[model samples]
Target: MEHSGKNKTNGFLLMLTLLSVIAVVAAPFVWDRFMEGQTGMIALIVVEVLLVIFIIASSHSLWKNSGSGEWKLKSDKKGMRVYTLKNPGETWLKIKIIGRLKARLASILTLMRNPDAADDVGMFDSYYIDGWDPDKDGVDPKLVYYTFKQKLFPPFKHREFVVKSEFSQDPVTKEMKFNFVAAPDKLPFNKRYHRVTEMHNRWKYTPLENGEVEYEFIYDAVDPGGNFPYALANWLIPAMLPFAFAKMPKILDKEKYRNAKMDYVQEVGEPAEAMA
Candidate 1:
């Protein structure tokens, strides 16, 4: 189903490109034949200008969907490096962040289980679990449902996401992973904000030999729904991610997270102390 969606998007983009080329080539002849006098000339100029803008925006969107671009370094701050990539035939931009945290897998998992605790980080205007499927042992549930309300700058309205996330561990690498996607139907819609229903994201944690967990985040695609321009949103997202991540080191320093331990997680060595 995902492949089919990608094919449809690519086809639509290709048709749009062909149509744009035809319009550009035909505009001069149209103006020469039907246009007359200053009024006609002004109308022609206006039409051409609008067409050019449309073409530019479409071209930019096409390039991002090409999926051949390299990971562009966007930001490096507070021990994390954020990179952005445009995957082929994807509407939303993809983001990857690589960093190390002075915590164990269990600590991070505990954080994931209690996402609302991180609200103090100020990354989102509001975030909390709306629902979940509890584990039999009453520990970490395999699936969690949550929502995030992000307050955007002026002219852009707030954005919200209702998501369902699942946790897993790689048998060979022992890497802990969380996969999440927008699940709009999981909850009733709210009219106050734009709801994001197109998103696929993942987080992976690999324990390193030096007692630090290598933290990697992959935002495969996140389409902030509504009329917001994709180009502007793409640029703004990367710029804002570093600020959100800068708060992580401190969040992990809290005793609840720093001292957390789980029998299921395989530690690299002795759990390292929180970063100063």
Candidate 2:
């Protein structure tokens, strides 16, 4: 099944590449024949440039393996390290973060299950508009959430996403994984916000002997819709991750999260010992 999916993807990428190349080659001639003016010439050039960028970005994103790339260390601070990979022909960078936090797995899971609770922490208050479980009924392990958020900076348009989130623990290793992926066609389109169509992220937590939880975060890729420049967005996105992660310890220190306990999640040791 997986191989079939890959073959389909490769075929699609090839078709897109051929079409893009043809368009790029034919654009100037079409402009010269049909529209012969300075303004028309400028528009033709813009179209050609955009088409080229699309071809490169799309081809790289679809064909290249997400994990198979040279990653450069971007930041190391407060026990967290951030790495980024700029794949050839891609406009945006893939990011990965590894860190150790003085928190329990249950507490982390609690936060993931209730992301809107972060609004009280003030960090995401302005950005997070709302979120809810689509099923309405309370369920364990798997949940579909629809989240609406606004950009932190200007051109503060809203972005909506529906993602299927799941929590799983390895029986042997005891490591916990929280995975999220874009859920397509789950809800009707809303005119209020731009719907984000592509996103895949995962968080892995490994309990250490001394009670600290070592965590790794992977952001595969995301396409923030609208006219935002991909280059600028890529730069700004990575710059914000460190700040967000540095605040995690403090956020988890809150009474609600610090004292959290879940029956589904197994802690490394006693909460008191871990906190101490």
Candidate 3:
């Protein structure tokens, strides 16, 4: 997704800072190795150059798409309501590129090396209920098991839930959609004290006239009595959403459905793939 305006500028600055730190850390060792005529000196130099080029290219791409996705709060009744808008102007080619990048980054090796690995549900999380057909799936949706992590303080926190989903169609738009409403069963820690007591993560996909698809993701959640007690979590959740949303188009672009293929095995007793 493209990030423009102030957000894009901020992201550029952050990427620059990160690259600088990486260069600083590697300079001394690289210089010494070059001076000592290390066996792999030529290879090392080539790799270093390639790494810098990659960083530059990736940063440029990100800077260009900084504002590719947008979010807005629609309501805050029992819970805060938010939705996403994938910049209407974004081209299919750009979307495909972004999706590929996401898939590559979410690959096994990358997740294993990620410091914030615990903060991801990764590829293993998927759910489907028996006898559940979307068209016939009425108001009462079936329970779905999934794992997700919440960014809390230093170390990340994880939450596993057996959430029930509800299905409905938009009256005006006739958009088919489903929403997670309750976590009938939750991890022990979350059972007693959890920021998300009630949640409605609604996903709606619309087929466009141009043969492309548009997606609208809505996240509505209640923090029962304000367990977080901070305005930051509310804001952060919306900002962090684009990443997950962005991954969907990527999967569709590849014309593959790993989750659908694995759903039966996963439900029958296969252990979920641990994110690194």
Candidate 4:
């Protein structure tokens, strides 16, 4: 539980780092677009220098977490670094309950992936608004598709992708794996410029000794999108990592909470629903 809180804090820090970087990078562009003629070249140079300083300061402040936990996240200028951690003490009991939780979890994942899914959670500030998913496929077992119309600044752009997906659980190892590969289709944007062109997403849940479970999530892509916003977007997209990683712990917590309540009811020899 203590570790969970620390992991949450790390996630928040990563988000702050990304937001700070975005602000740092976008300010000069925004200023040039709005006040280009008004501001002299010298003034623009000064602003650019100040922007560099701000970026340095903000990035330093946001990524300076020194917490020890089962959750580890590491990112660098090139891209997200490979890090792995496991949540120990997760039992594979209650098959029916676990199955329900998995289904609900998949639904939640669909909501997260589809930026136009009403945005009830408000996960992204600027996201797809139009007919991104005309097929109405929520979360398919064989294939996953997405067509994105995203607006970060003045203009809105479209992004489309299809993934060949597989979801399976191993009874022997008690590991559940979800893997996907980008389809070989002509993308809306250039393959060299787009961020998600050659995308491959791998998600796994492996139960360890002592009733613990280790989660491994790997997201691989050619490019995230075009250079301007997509460059920053390459960093921003992974900010949602902590949120995704935290969900399973939460689901397990719910199961534990429910079982504890049921245990108390059994101890008292009373019907739980009737009591309510």
Clash tally, candidates in order? 1, 0, 9, 8
Among the numbered candidates, top lDDT falls to 1
Task: Score candidate 3 by lDDT.
Answer: 0.42
lDDT of each: 0.73, 0.71, 0.42, 0.45
Name the weakest run of 10 consecutive residues (lDDT summed) in model 1.
267-276
Tell me which of candidates 1 and 4 scores higher on TM-score.
1
Rank order (by lDDT, best first)? 1, 2, 4, 3
Worst 10 residues of 3 by lDDT: 91-100
Candidate 2's C-alpha runs over 4 A off are 1-68, 120-140, 269-276
User: Cα miss at 273, model 1 (Å)?
Assistant: 24
Q: TM-score, each model?
A: 0.69, 0.66, 0.38, 0.37
In angstroms, what RMSD does candidate 1 have relative to the true structure? 7.0
Clashing pairs in 2: none
**Per-residue lDDT for 235-275 in model 1, tens only?**
77788777776667787778888787654455454333321
Cα-lDDT of candidate 4: 0.45
Residue pairs with colliding backbones in model 1 are: 67-88
The predicted structure with the larger lDDT, 1 or 3, is 1
Instruction: State the displacement of the C-alpha of residue 75, model 4, in Å, after optimal TM-score superposition.
Output: 7.0
Most TM-score-accurate candidate: 1
